[model samples]
Target: MLAQYLLGKFRALVRLLIQCVSPRQVKLETATYLRGSKTSELDDEDHNVVEWAFSGAYDGDKPILIDAENPARSLSKNKSLDLVTRLSGSFEPGSTVCLHLQNNILYPILVLAILATGCKWTGTNPACTRSELEDHLRVSRSKYIITSEDHEDMVFDVLCRMDEDIELILFSDVTVERPPSKDGKHPTLHDLLANSTFLPLESRYQRLSARTAATLMASSGTTGLPKMAIRAHGALVCESRSDELQDAHKPYKIRRLFCTPMFHAYSFPKMVINPLRQGQPTYYMQRFDDTFIQKLSLYSITDIITVPPILSRLVDQARGGDAKPLLQSLRTIICAGAPLTVKLRDEFIQLFSNPPQLIQEWGMTECGCISRAGDLDADMPTTVGRPVAGYLVKISQEERVEIPGGGFASELLVKGPQLMDCYLGDDSATASHVTSDGWYKTGDVGYLDARGRIFLVDRAKDIIKVNGWQVSAAELEKTVLQVPGVMDAAALSMGHSLDEHPYICVVRTDHGVSEKEIREVLRSQLSRYKGSRCELQFVDGLPRAASGKLLRRKLKAQLTHREK
Candidate 1:
């Protein structure tokens, strides 16, 4: 009753405020309509943020539930400036906005938007063409773009390709190569920020629709075309509950290191955006380096968002005395992307003062974070953790059985608002992935136990059937990475032979581990049937994206070329 009463008061207050701001009397029903209806047979889970907003739950008057108090040396010299100044200027209501740049800078902007009284911050892919960029701008209905000096030309060029008048916020004054005549157009990012002024925009009871674009991010297009992933505010509200995935929210002022590309799911949701709701400072590496990670304690850093390979580098650092006790300051470390092996996870835990939690989260570009296993118990390194709060996941039976529990690990399907509304410009692809029932079929295979924890076995695409026996490529790579001097490994099957075993390629580190040593290690780990048929090839490093995800298909392409 108390919650209901407070919500009623909140609605009245916002109604009064909106009328006061607009000269003409605002449309009570048209301006903010909070209702519940559906055309689908099964739409019980649909949540509308706009409805919640009108009722006060999502009203703009709510202070950020996520706390931001980093006493530790987390905030960068520039991040402090970004946390306030940037949002105050860019998120003015009634004005359209667009943000383009690299992944490293968008983290802070996402944080600022949550505090911007219901402003929508649309994103564009850095690798997108002028055509795609312009199309997204027109469709999204953005008025301005917050860009950097590096992208000034591209943004202006993209603008020229569009019909709308565009505004910009540039951080640096940069120009291209000098010409003899020196008669080319050039402008600084600072030029716009200084001249642009933003007024106070406080519209109470503001909430985005459940289907409204929460924030825009693009997929890397490993399989096909790059597409925009639409996230609705209600999904964000659900994703915001991801904080509960951590056993207890530690109230600490610690510097968090961000090295992953924030545009994708690997880091943006799990590492950067989620942590900000806690109100801690996150330091950006703009670029990644092992040495930069090695010297983090010098900055009083306690947490880091990284992939396994980077952790492998840190483990290498621990083997030496260079980073030493200073590395001890690292309170917690998180890993995502590829699976972490038992050997690697154990080594990382031992190096920590008291085994920092190794939070392994699982998700994709289309769906934000779905489940997170806070840390791997020594017994269950292969098992990714439980589903985050407000999330439900199930695995389909590989074969049709009389009755199969969706809870069992099969093909992991997620049903949550945190999922993308569609793959930009590709309705067929979107429909193919998302079922009419609101369940998204994740290509990766995993099962949930009674505890609701998600354990991934392998990607369905990478699974190989050997005489009707199931074989996991990831299982092979995990064993290969354990060989003495072997730094990294990846596995893939090339062909279906008489017995159905395909060619497997192994990428190695510069640690001098040889083919013979790797083969011997696999022999010890695998059965004779699996081991005798294996082949090994040594290469420099695995082919991966900027975000550190391996592209086995690319590796196979490289191998095919060599054979040709």
Candidate 2:
């Protein structure tokens, strides 16, 4: 295994050197490209036929969702189609639905069912509070919400506060004795599907156009709350059929386990929807656990969809020599959502005798996937590779720093077909993100190599990453302000990449307020990733400009000085 690993690495290095010596343009072949006006190639009259196509690909006895129950329960593709057909009746055409279920078997079926009926959908983070839930509902203006039985009470409370007649569907099979009869409007997903007959009406999907919003994706913001980016049907379709790998000649069989939250853009559309379209199977977990690492062997996982922190944990386990033997079947590992530190990447390569081919991708919610590492001469681990097809990337130099391999540092700007339609109900915000000529300001600082690969340096946005999840510094400051005696607060990132932690410096109005009390209040209000293990410090005051603008660079410098 060690010899094979060395041989593979040597081959990759040779390929990189050869490509560098004899550089060639990777041309976009128009003949092989699949062009469609909508999610499917079917005309308006045949639009409803798309649902049947999904089932037809895997009609035979093939399982879809597999979880790590004592004895794993799997659902066949045919059985899933039946449930989706019945659930389609509950949703109306041209309406938005909120899908907030944790990583459960019902997620993929519910998503396809919503798309089948031409109703737009958006996902909600399970960590959201009632107030955040209310804000998400208001911003998306959804007509229905589908959540697990665990969140029934919270969903009800938030809906009542909204004062809207939104329908609620609890995605659960566990029967509970209610007060003789509950409200007819709020029904369990089991009851809804069991009560309705499977009506395979073609008209249900016919009215949807390519321009219709298929998803209301959330974009992490540096200030205020997260903005809703409206992803169109055309955008999803393009991403689903993206032929980014030029070396592939035939279909590749993938049995993957996706550990990221389903609400994320990468895990949802790329790992779930795209795999479903290709008739591939993906396993799910409510969250990462000890059992999750064990399933790599149990399920014979060929591919893994993961983020940086999870990889860090895996590295730790492998170093202990407990998890190394179980990872033999892994052929590919794709890392995204956060920076993959060079140290971690090298450690992973050294630990496994026959390591999986590591690939890195760089993208944002606004644009589906801009670059893939496989397409460029990725001799350096920091480089994120060249832009994928149908997208163009350029650098807007804000810094004069130049790197040896990666060129001058600047703000990365992009223009692509998969760019989102707009931010929901916020035209000014939409206009601010996108340029008049169509390029979207990614707010990420990076440099482009001569070969077109992008290498990131820093972020222009004031955000911190906790386990690859974006935590807004502004949002943290706002939450800290809610605590009594917190006159002023500022949050900044400490360390780099996945090692980064949210560090807060607070100015107290009252001397009685202790750090423990303030931290307890924050933990209650914010999610665990944002609050639980955050570093807190009492400061005299946060640096600010005369016009009340936060001088974050100065605060960062102060932190540097303190560490020194």
After superposition on all C-alphas, the RMSD of every candidate to the true structure, in Å, is 17.4, 5.5
Question: Lowest-lDDT window of 10 residues in candidate 2?
Answer: 27-36
TM-score for all predictions? 0.59, 0.86
- Residue 497, model 2, lDDT: 78
lDDT tens digits by residue: candidate 1, 358-458: 67766666776666665333234566776555555766555322213332345777776567788656687688778898878787766555444566655
Tens digits of lDDT, candidate 2, 1-564? 565567567745654475465223432111111111332222222222234336335544577666656324766666666666767766787788999778766677777678778888889988787877887787788899988767888899888878887888877642222332255546777676656656773455556655667888877655557789988776765555553232133234678787678778877665456544556566877888767778888878878877888888887887888778877777678888888887887777666555567888788788877776752344567778767666778777455556443336767788766789889888888898888998788888877654556778888788787877778888888888888888999988887878788899999896446888888877777777778768999888888999999899899898899889
Best by lDDT: 2
Which pairs of residues have clashing backbones in candidate 2? none
Q: For candidate 1, report its TM-score.
A: 0.59
- Compared with the true structure, the alpha-carbon lDDT of candidate 1 equals 0.55
Off by over 4 Å in 2: 1-60, 70-72, 173-185, 194-198, 243-252, 375-378, 397-407, 510-512
Model 2: lDDT of residue 89 = 63
Candidate 1 residue 193 C-alpha distance from true site, Å: 4.2
